[model samples]
Target: MGDLKILICVLIFSIKTVHSTKSKPHIVIIIADDLGWNDVGFHGSNQIPTPNMDALAYNGVILNRFYTLPQCTPSRAALLTGQYPMRYGYQGIPILAGENRFLPFQIPTLAKKLKELGYDTHLIGKWHLGQGYRNATPGAHGFDNHFGYWNGFMGYFNHEATGGNMVGLDMHHNDEPVWDTRGQYATDLITEKSEEVIKGHNESKPLFLIVSHLAVHTGKGGVDLEVKDIAENNKKFGYIQDERRRMYAGMTDELDKSVGDTIKALAEKRILDNTIIVFFSDNGAPTIGSALLDNTGSNWPLRGQKFTVFDGGVRTVAMIYSEQLQNKGTINNELIHITDLMPTLYYAAGGDVASLGKIDGINQWLTITKSEKSQRSEALINIDEARNVSALLTDGGRYKLINGSTVFSEVDGDFYGETGRDDSNPEYNTDDILHSSVNILLRGNLTQEKILNLRKQMELKSCRKSTIDHDSCRYNSVCLFDLFEDPCETTNIANKFPEVTERMKSKLEKYWSEVKVQRKGFLDPNANPVYYNNTWYPWLEDTRCHVGDLRTILLS
Candidate 1:
């Protein structure tokens, strides 16, 4: 009897200890579609209301210099894999049905790692990284539960493709169709499902829910006079209409409310205090002159909008609400990229993330929790071939970078300057399109002396023979500039401060080469076709019939 009692006591103590140590906090990542820095109240927007997001920022750490890949799919890919989009195959947006480009299976994701550590992974919203039909589906990647669309954008009223039906593009609730229903908005549906996911969870384990909403992207062509009329009289028509701006603003308002509802649900369940809620945009706003939505989202006082490498195209608003870190109402200007989220989450959970494998993102928990200004010393930014851009050491709130392609040495990639806007692209009015309030510095500033020294530094840290090879790569080294001094990217100080540019360029090259070696590309050659045969996918399924035959449906 005595021996049995002792054994029981030991077992009870072990059980208690395990429960205490394994009390991992829940994590919620909320990503808005094509949202801009000036679109939210947290960033001083008086036109559109975003109370929930404002509260999140007010009670958390607002990352003033947060960045993301310039495009949607690429940003998602980078955030998921903790690597540059180019390293993987998802460099641009995927529109075709059954596209196979996705983050490699070998690359560990936040969902996969958290699940392995006994957490319930739920993805509730847009999964544009890849279609849900192919091996690109969220379920195949690492998410245990996925309820959203498989493509870039979808209609708000009907869950169908933005305008009409598109094959394999129906709204889904985990490999199942969300039956066609009227009076249901896509944003509300996403929020509803997200709330359900949080409420329905039985708490068998810790949770990691991603509430990725598709609101504020394209407001169904910005119709609906009540919503569209808000922007009255074509207020500064650089690219879009006033009505369209109003419609987009309305969408943002709804998105904010949706976030509020979700937050309310978490608090109702008493999980708000223990959970870490992260809110950020996937990428910059779409800058196409005719696109109704992007024109409405003024990135304001920043350079460029969407698709370009300028600050507006890549820079975004990011905030984290967590009680453990005691991060509230503080603005952090330290340079941090989207890739850093995965590793930071891992560290926050207090789990052994090292054993999972090497990742490009460094754990930035200190920067968030402690409000340490000097946490991040350097960071890099890359967007396909437009620009071979990189940022070197951050010194006292000042950011220095070497911007210019290796082969396109003379070619300036400044998307936010007078030369960049006026000198190129005849189709669109570059001045009207370049809405940035800042200037950009470029190649002319880097003199021959600085260029030579930079070249020598590149020679030492050369990646010309490394694995990540690009046929279009230009000169290996270049000049450095304080973006604040020259946001237009016109000045080439390589001659004056050749040594500084050389040193920074060398650092960038070494880092790029190392990343190239580790991220072996993954490819999927499957053709899973679209859900409905319509105008977008005319080759396959089409829901509407015209003249007794299938014909293209034009959007006015």
Candidate 2:
């Protein structure tokens, strides 16, 4: 009788524990800025040690086929609204600081969607959506609190951004400039703030937190490579010969620690067991010679850099961690887009996907957690009419149709390295980066055996150079590649596979026809930070003239 009672009690407790932790898991996303494909340890980059990210990735599921826009702002917009940036005219170029352009007020962000479900939502860093108007701020976008910059790139120490040829303070605690912490390093500051938020959260309500870090992304102007503690940073990355690369390595290390620290906070708070954590870069690194922000991170063996439609710019290092996942520590090659995040996480939070309305995103919760077949078959990479640049992904992403010059001149079609065109010894020098997931739960030979099998089955050949000429690619031309065969997109197969190119073109046209073109925002003179006590603020709010007129001008 006593044994029977004890067994019943144990079973009841187990059921309760499972239900509490798995059903209403806290959703967290850590967004790394301008991180390269080969920047992570799991991606086989021995240059920078990212053990924290590696440990989490090894414990979780690594997203092998994740895709995003070639730029940060558009990707962020896609993530927030669960729709293609082309729908709102954000496909062309990122939102420039001091521009009147912003995300349309009609669309609800991921924060808003979760907030509707009674989650305590917060955005801890980098709100690049637009902050010209109060309505466009993160607070108006559904975050209960916003502690970060509004522009694209800013100084890591000073928290100042140079836009419209003028530099000004950009950090904020909601709408006000965070002047007091001017000299502080943004990576450390952002991490501390995230830890603070997590520690203080009420466990009764599910938390939706986005830590959009500024680490690994080069800062504005002269202070390009921002390191937290110079002495400590130098000591760790002493093996790196070049000063620039060494600085970048240090920045990456800080980001790795940030990840560990954040996970630690959650564990300490006892919410980690019930938390669903997703981490990925906003876009690929710029590398040495790329005209896109001139960062020092490397995307070696993957052609092109940031602001290009190539895999180096689109595909990112990504992973998801959760105790609730049925198959942890695996690689998922699902056809996922940045837009998928909103619906995927919404469904994970027990919200109805139907409530999200007619967004372009498909709910990928099951595809991620249960290892179910990817429900999505195609993704519209982008249709940037402004830059006359675009690319279309089709046939379940086995093929990609490129319609514009992927800014290949800067990235050099066929020329690639950590040193850009130098073609020196590159990182991840292997022919392919094998899908990097080894279930650490297995012991000894089983782990090694599984790793070997995984390497063979999931190997992806990232070509170093191409036979095709790219002179035509410098103009508005077409290129098609079977991404499965040539993941680096070296060979332009438009002529060889004319029918496939035509089909992909037709699919792109359909999406292009449906685009609701967004007007580019002009640099408002009033937006000069010099006007607002040398701090970046919503200058339009203070204007006595008609706000409608400015918006109408932009629309016209």
Best-fitting candidate, scored by lDDT = 2
Task: Please provide, for model 1 over 64-126, each residue's C-alpha lDDT reduced to its tens digit, 9 standing for 90 to 100.
Answer: 778787667778877887766656545544333344344566677888888888888999878
All candidates' TM-scores?
A: 0.71, 0.87
Count of backbone clashes, every candidate in sequence: 39, 0
Candidate 2 lDDT, 215-311, residue by residue in tens: 8888966248978677887777766677888888888888987987787677657677688899999888887563567677777767667888878
Error of 2 at 290 (Å): 6.8
